[model samples]
Target chain A: MSTISLEQIQREMAAAVMTPLTPDDNMRKEAPDGRSMERVAASFIAPNSRLTSFERLEIYNRQYWYRVLGALAEDFPALRTVIGSRAFDAMSVGYLKAHPSRSFTLRNLGGQLASWLTTNQHFAARRADLAVDVARIEWAFVEAFDGAEHEPLTLEQIATLDGGSYLALQPHLQLVELTYPVDDLVLNLHKQEKRQATEAGVKHDEDDHAPAKLPPIRRKPTYLAAHRVDYSVYYLRLNRGEFHTLRAIRAGRPLGEAIEAGVTTARVPAARRPQLVRQWFTAWAELGWICAPDLDRLVRST
Target chain B: MKNQLNAMLLTAALSGLIGGTTVAHAATTSASKTTVKAAKAGLQYVNGDKPAKHSCKGKNDCKGQGGCKSSDNGCKAKNSCKGKGGCATDGSKMPKAV
Candidate 1:
C-alpha cells in the first residue's frame, strides 16, 4: 500500500477543488488528466453512507468557486453594474483563475482587475475603455478607504519654500486621468446599487431581474483625485495643469520645476496663473494633501 | 521672461497671500468646481461573507421564506435568518449557467 504524505494529499485535494466546474456547476466526472474523478476522490475523501466519494468532494469544489465569486462581486459592485452581472461573472472567473487568491485577505482580489480588463476588452461588452476606467476608480476607492494618513504642511512651512522645494501628497490620495467622466458615473452607480439593495433588501441574479441599464456616458477627458478626508473618501476634480503639476511633484520634482511643468500646459491665463496656483495650494493644505516630503532629499536638493 | 514670471508667481503665492477671499472666490469658478465632498455609500460585505441576499441561482437578492434550496422557482431556503452559516451552492457556477 502506498502511504501518501500530508502535503501530497493536500496538493491533490486542492487541485481537485480548484478545477473549473462543469456547465451545470458540478465537479467533472474526470480529471483534466483523464483520471476518473471517482478513483481520485476515493484516494482522499471517504464516501459517506448517502454520498459517494465523488459527490462528497463535489461539495468543496462548489463552495470554493461560490465563495470566491461572491466575494469578487462584493468588491466590484460598480464594475458588475457597468458590465451587467452576466458579463461580470465571466470576467471574475477568468481574472480569479489567472491570478488565484494569493493573499490571506480577499480585499486584494480585484487589485489586478483594471489591468486585466485592459487586455480582455471583450468582457466589457463593447464598453471596454469605460469598464477599465470604472474598474480603476472602484479599486482606487478601496485603497483610499484604507490607505495611510499623513499630516499636511502648514502655510508657514509652505512660505519657507522656494521653487526648488520638494513636496509630498498624502498616502491615501489617488490620481487618475480618464477619458470618461467616470467619477460621477461610479458614484451614481454606487447610489443606485444602495437603493436597489435597500428596496429588494436583496441583490438578485441578472436572470431574475432585467440587466442594469446605464445612462449614455459621453467621452470627456477628466482628471480626478480620490482622497480621504475625515475618514470619508471624496472625489476631487482637477484641471490639466493641476493634475500634471501634482504628478510632477509626486515624481520628486522640485517646486519650481513642478510649477513650471504645470504652468506651461496650464489653460489659465498668465495673469491668473499665480492666483490659481495659490488657490490650488490652499485647497491642498486644507485637504491635508501636501504632506512633508523626504526631509533628507529636500535638504539635499535645497 | 517665462522663468522670471514663474519665479515671481511662486514668490507672490508662497508669501502671506493665502486666506484671501479674492482667490477663494476664484476657486469657486464654474470651471473650478474643486470642492471636497464624500459619497455616502452604505454597501457592506466582507470578502467571503455571503451577502444576506445571495440566493441560490447566482442571484443574490433573497431566498424568501420556506423556498426550495436549488430550484429556479421562487423557493426560499429553510434558513433565511441564519447569517454567515455556511456556503450552500445550488449547483450553479459563475461565468456559466447555474
Candidate 2:
C-alpha cells in the first residue's frame, strides 16, 4: 500500500488529540464542546483507555510538553524575568508554535530556542540581541550539565607536548561569547526572584509583590566558559586573555602558540608574559581543570 | 469457488495488515511507560490532591495542604465579586482589591 498522505495523517492526529478516553481502556473522542463522548469515541478514539491506552497517551502528551516547557523556563528564567509573566507565557506559546517538540526525549526541546528567539517575529520585537544572548547563556548552562566530561589539560601533559603538539579540549567544555552582559542579568534576576519569595514569606498573606527591576545594562561584550567539575556544573567568566588562550588551545594550537595568542591579546610586557602564563596554568590546575597528557595512549588508540 | 477463496484470502491479508489488536497493545505499552516516567518526575494529575475539609475562622487561618479545599484546591471565595479570588486572613481583603 502507498504511504498515508501527510494531510490525512494530520487530520487523524488531530482526531487522536481531541479524543478523550475513560479508565476502562477505551477511547472517547468527544469534543470538549458539549458533544457526546460516545459519538466522539466511535469516530476517532480507539478502544485503549481501559488497561492503559488513552491514559498513557494523554499522560505522555501532557507530561512531555510540561517537562520541556519547564526545562526551557528554568534555563531562560532571565528572559522570562525581563518580559514578565504575561509576555513570557505568550513568548512560550510562540516558541512552541515555531519549534514543536518532535524528539522522543523532552530534554532536547530548548536547543532551538536561542535561534528561535533571534529569528522569530514575535520575539524579535523585544531586545532581540540581549534576549538571544540570554538564551545562549541558558542553553550553554543546560548543555554544560548534560554533555559528556573530559579531563582538562594538565601541567605534565603540557610539558611533554612542548612546542609542536596541539591541544584538544574535552567534549564537555563549552565557550560562549555574548554581546550583552547576559550572565549578570540572569544572576541578578535569579537573586531578585529569591528575594521576592523571601519577602512574600515575611509580609504574610499579601500577594502583591511586583517583579524586580532590570539591572543597568552593560556595554561591553562578555566571555564565559562552562565546564563540569566533580559532577557539578560551574560557569566561570573569562577575561580576554583567558578566553583567547582557551580558544586557541581548543583549536588544537601548540601550548606556545596558545600562550602567544593570550599574550598578544592580553598585551602584557615581554618580561611578565612567562610569569602571567605560569599563573594562568597554575590556577587552572588548582581548579581541577587539567588532565595529564597521554601521548602514548593517543598513539596506540589511533 | 476459486474466486471466492481468493477474496477470502485478500480479506485475511488486509486484516493482518491493519493489525488492530497489536496496535492497541503497543499504544497501551507506550502510554504506561509515559505514566511511570511522569510519576517519577513528581508531576501529578489535576485530581491527584486529596480534598481537604477544614473551616477557617479568619481569612488566613488555614495554612498548608490540609486547609479548606477551594475549587482549585485552595481558598476560593463565593458571590462577593471576587470571581475566583481568595479572601485574606481578616476575611476583608481580596486578591485583586489589594
Candidate 3:
C-alpha cells in the first residue's frame, strides 16, 4: 500500500553484502512488505535467459569473497604454504568475518589479518606467534614497496651533524622484533610452494598440511629494519648492538648516550666497542638512514 | 447493468495482461542494453587473448573439469582457467569435499 521504508531497504542491502543468495530465497516483490530479497537481487542484475535472479546474484556474492580471499592469499604466500590450503582458506574466512572490508580499495582488505591470525583459535593450536611474525614481515614488505615515498636523508646532511644532536629515522621505517626466524621460514616456504605448483597440474584443496614444529628460539630477539631505499625496498636486519644503538637514537638520545645504551644492552667487548660504533655510524650514514638535527632554527627561535 | 459489468471485467483483464507483459519487456530490454559484455583486463602476456574485464559465475565453472579453482585474483577468471591453463602456475584449484 505504501512505499518500502529506507531502513528496510538498507537492511536488505547489508544482508546482500554479507551473505550469499539462493534461488529459492524470498527476493521477489510479491509479498506485502515489498522488501522481497528477490526484487533487491533483481534490481542489481538483469534476468538471464538461462538463470533466475537468485542464480545471477550468486555469481557476484561468490566473486566478492573470492576477490578478497585472493588478495589475502597473495600477501601471505608463505603463510599459506605453512598452513596449507584448507586451513588457510578457513583462517581467511574467519579473518574476513571479524574485519570486513572498510576501505574503498580491496588492497586494504587484509589490514587486520596478521593480528587476527595471531589470536585465531586455529593458529593458537599451531605456531600462532610464528604465523603472526611471518604476516607482519609480509605486510611490511607490501607497505614498503607500494606506500608513498619521501626524500631520504642525504649524505650532505649527515656530514655536518653536531656531536650533541640526535638522528631521526623516517616515519615509514618500521622496526619489528620477533621470537622466530620467520623471515627465513617465509622465504623457504615460498620456494617450496613454487616447486609444488610446478609439479601439480592443478592445486588440490587437500594441500592443507600442518607445518613442522620449530625449535624454541634460543637467540636474542631478532630485530628487523624495514624501509624503502631509492625506488626499491629492503629490510636490513640488525644485530643486538646495532638494534639497541638505533633504538636509542630513535628515542632522541644524543650520540654519546646512544652508544652507552648500546653497550649496556649488548655488553660490547671493550676492545671491539669503538670499532663497532665507528662501523655502525659509517653504515648508517652510507644508507642515509639518519636525519640531521634542526638546531639552527631552534637556536634562532630561542 | 449486467452488460456494463462484463465490459468492465474485459477492460481490467486486458490492462492486467498489458501490465505484466510490459514489465517483462522492460526486463528484456535491460538485459540486452549493453553491446559489449566483457572488457579487456589488459594483461596480454599471461593469457594469449585479452582477458575479459567482466565475467559471469559459470563463465569459469570449469564443467570440462570436475571442479574449478576459486581465486579472487583480478587477473584470472573465477572458475575457468582461461589460457593460462589450470592452477599449475598459481596452484589455485577448486577444493573438493574429501
Candidate 4:
C-alpha cells in the first residue's frame, strides 16, 4: 500500500470491477491476474463495521455490469426489439467484454456493434442479416444525433467545381446500405417505446418488456442517408444511383467523376436520369448534407 | 460527350437548389412512411400517471429516444433542426459509470 502508485490502484480496481459476471450474475471467486479475490479486495478496499472489503467490492462489480448493460440497452432499444431481451442482454455482455467502454461517453458504446455483429452472427439468432441491419441503422441514429455538423457548400460554390473538385457530406450524415428496410422497423419500435415510456411513466426493464412475437420483417434492399436537419435526424431513402454517387463523393472522387459514376449506376433510363438526380441534389441541399471538406477533418471522418 | 452530359445534368440540379422554390422532402420524407414493414411492441399502459421509471443514478431526466426524437422540436428555420443532445443528468461524475 505504501509503495503502490495511484495509477496502479486505479488499474487494479478497474480490472477487478470489469471482470465478467457469471451466468447467474455473481462475481467470480477468482480474478484474471490469478490472485485471491478476497485478498485483492482487502488490499485496496477497506472493510466497514457490517460489510467486508470483498462484499463492498462485489457491489461495485455487480453495478459495473448493470450500468453498462443498461446504457447499451438504451442506445440500442430497437436492436433489443429485433432480438429478444434475453439474447440482447447476453450479446451486450459479450460485446462489452470484447469492446469495453473505451470512450469517455457511452454514446460510442455501440460504435463497433454492427461490425461486431458481423463476426458474432450467432447472437443475431434466426434473422442474422436483419439483426445486423437493425444494428447498423441504430448505430447510424446515434452518430447522426451527436456527430459533428458543418456548413454546407452553397449552390454557387458547387457550380464553380469541375468533375475533379473534391466534395464531401456533412460529418453527421451517415450513408447506410442495408439489406432490409430497417429504417421503418426502427421507427416503429422507437415510437412504440416512447408511447410505452410515456404511459408507464418509466422506461421498461429487460424482462419487463420482453416483447410478444412480432410479424417477421421481409428483406428489401434499402439505401439510406441518415442525416440531421435543424438538429432532428431523419432517414432519407435514396435510389441506387444516388447512393453510389454520394458514396463516391464521400470517397473523395471529384464532382465530375462522382456524377459520372452515379449516372452509370442509375437504374432509371437515361431520359429520366436528369430528373431523379435533380431531385436528389435538391433534397441534399435543402437538408444541408453537402459540405466543403476541411482536409484534416475529412480524412478522420471517412 | 458523357462528361458534357453530366455537366449539363449537374447544372439543372444546381438550378433547382439555387431557385429554392420547390420544397423537396418528397424523395426523403414521403418514402419513410410509405415503405413501412414492422412489428410493434409494448402497446399496453401497465403503469398509470407516475409509472415505474428507473435510472441507474436514480434521477430520471432522459426521455427514451429511438431512431427519432421523443419530443420533436420540428425544424424551426429551414437550416436549424431540434435534436436531443447528451442527457447524463446525474449531476455528479463519480456515479456516471453506475
DockQ for each numbered candidate:
0.09, 0.01, 0.01, 0.10
Highest TM-score model number = 4
Model 4: clashing residue pairs?
A: A163-A256, A202-B53, A230-B80, A230-B81, A230-B82, A231-B81
Ranking by TM-score: 4, 1, 3, 2
Query: CA lDDT of each candidate?
Result: 0.69, 0.51, 0.54, 0.68
* Candidate 2 residue runs with Cα over 4 Å from true position: A1-44, A47-64, A102-104, A121-124, A153-156, A195-212, A291-302, B1-98
* Candidate 2 CAPRI assessment class: incorrect
Better of 1 and 3 by lDDT: 1
Span of 10 residues, lowest total lDDT, candidate 3 chain B: B36-45
Local accuracy of candidate 2 as per-residue lDDT tens digits, B1-98: 64443333333322322332233234347856444323322111112221211232122233212212222212222122143222122234546854
- lDDT of model 1 at residue A258? 82
Give the Cα error of residue A43 in candidate 1, in Å.
4.2
Better of 2 and 3 by lDDT: 3
> For candidate 4, lDDT tens digit of each residue in A177-205?
99987777787787777687778874547
Q: Per-residue lDDT for A1-302 in model 3, tens only?
A: 34567787566555565552223322333323446656776664445445566545554455566667766786677777666566777787678868876665555676677777766857435657777777887776555434543344443443444445566655445666776766666656655655566688455533456654554544446877666543334576777777787787777786556666675566665555555665555555434455554557446645
Off by over 4 Å in 3: A1-15, A20-50, A159-167, A170-172, A198-220, A227-233, A247-263, A269-274, A292-302, B1-75, B79-98
lDDT of 2 by residue, A23-119 (tens): 3324444544566544433343334323223333343234334444454564566776665555555567568756766664444667788878777
Rank order (by lDDT, best first): 1, 4, 3, 2
On residues B1-98, what C-alpha lDDT tens digit does candidate 4 reach at each position? Answer: 77567877777666645543233234236555222211011111111222222321112233123222222221112111113111112122445463
Between prediction 1 and prediction 2, which has the larger TM-score? 1
